[model samples]
Target: MPAPQFDPAAPLQFVVNAAAGSNAAASKREIIESVLQAQGRRGELAFCTPADLARVARVSAQKALSTRTAVVAVGGDGTLNTVAQAAHAAGCAMGVVPQGTFNYFARTHGIPADPAQAVRLLLHSVPAPVQVAGINDRLFLVNASLGLYPDLLEDREAYKARFGRSRWVAFVAACTTLLRAQRQWRLRIETGGTVRDVHTLTLFVGNNRLQLQQLGAEPEDTIAGTPGDGSMAALVLRPIGTLSMIGLMLHGAMGRLGEAAGVERFEFDHLVVRPTLPQGRRGVKVAFDGEVTTMRAPLDFRVLAKPLYLLGPQRSTATAEAVSRAEDAGA
Candidate 1:
């Protein structure tokens, strides 16, 4: 796809997610205005509450494609996911303005936190196509993890209400749950004509094909590749003893574990996962961009290559290229 065009003379429309970032609306508005001033551009802002993000995103994306207006997602990953997906479906271009606690996607792609810097990048940067992950019909911008982590998203609203947006607080809550969580999953994974029977603790599917910070890498060396490679990666983590699981968690926390033998990782265009045990019949808890849903026993996932027009600094291209090469070489 071609790069997204920006006309400084034209107004940039922002669909802001007000409920994000600790429910601090005033600070977000100030940041937006300051960024516009810094970019020397004047634009219109549309504030959206959490309840409105999905509908507003569709409207904004349609308007952007129809009128060729610049639409930006100004919130955390979830907000970005909603807007970007709409833009992709509508065949329009989009940019992201990170304002949430963990803007991991933005940071990985070199999107600035300061609205002005991000706007400047968006105005001048080339639009690079980025891939997305989808399970059945649901799409995910970042990786989706099933099991204990997803269960956290199942209670996100309550957790956010009680703990606010602090990652530490969320982590504590998750750990508390994990202590009693059972990993009695019997999974059948099919990829590249091979079907493997595995009992795992978690299943994480990443569209960008990159190993996340805390999450382990795909056992098949899939994450080292290009983001828009038109392929998806999977990391199937078998359930170790709880004590060993804790040790692995610490290793991942301290940044020590990557591509260990115990973990199985693979890359594919499509796959199916089914449970072998009756207790697993209710299906697993699946998470899509922080939203949780209970899925049937069998799950299907695929990669949508070059689905979004991402704006970033000039260095992103080089970094992405390097990563792609590394993935190809199984680095």
Candidate 2:
């Protein structure tokens, strides 16, 4: 089926993550409103706390479908992922206005980081199919992980709360978390009808090729071109000492993680992982697109059967190379 066409007269539903940034929500609101008013386009802004993100996104997405409009996600990858879940489930078109650190999803999809620019672009753009992956029932656009990676995200949030949000602080937080890492996950991984057990510090899945590239976790031709042209990638980090872990961080910082020792990379369409947990524990901490949450064991990770339609500006070859036809009519 083809994507819904862009209807300028229809009201665009914008779900704002109130807890994403330190800046005043009013300032962000003004920026969005100014662009909409200047273009004479109808837009509805719904500001909700992080605690209310899931609920608000669901409501906004249903409203968008009812009104025959696109629901816009305005924040970081976590916000985008949350909104994407609702939009994908409803088969509604979605737009993005990036406002978080890294902005990997937006940048990869060619959505401008500047709120006004992104909104303006979406106002005149049509929707195209974009590949999205899932971990259990939750959607993750950038990446997803378990064990040490999730722990790192929790620590990163704490560091951000105290030192403010920035790439540097996130790095420091990751280092802090790595120095104390000791737990190792023993997982039974099943893929392609083959099962294997392994011990790893973290099992990370990648959907956005840009991120995989940055981390040097390239997966040949399977990592690019969404919808029918690409597959998801996975990375496994073997347990290592603190000093070795520090070296691993340096490799990642320098964009050579794939070449780092004790690191394994592979591509797959679907995977099932069963982790051995402590006695009496039935759930495990998992992080998807920067947000950490507890999920029941026996995680199912796979490329979703249906792609989410994204409305945005056509990007240059550089940014959209990961998904070369992401903005095309046939995408």
Worst 10 residues of 1 by lDDT: 219-228
* C-alpha lDDT of residue 237 in model 2: 92
lDDT of 2 by residue, 1-331 (tens): 6676556689999999985454768888889999988998779989889889999999999989888889999888788989999999888899999888877677677777678888998888878787888899888888889989999999999999999999899989998898889899999999878899999999998888777766776765543443222688888999998778888989988878988888988878889999999899999999999889999989999888788889866555326543443333113
lDDT of 1 at 4: 54
TM-score of each: 0.82, 0.91
Question: lDDT, candidate 2, residue 55?
Answer: 97
lDDT tens string, model 1, 270-307?
77877664653566678877777777767887675546
lDDT of each: 0.68, 0.84
Native-to-model Cα distance after best TM-score fit, residue 296 in candidate 2, in Å: 1.0
Model 1 off-target regions past 4 Å?
A: 1-8, 19-23, 155-160, 209-230, 259-262, 276-284, 315-331
Point out where model 2 deviates above 4 Å. 19-23, 221-229, 315-331
Candidate 2 has what TM-score? 0.91
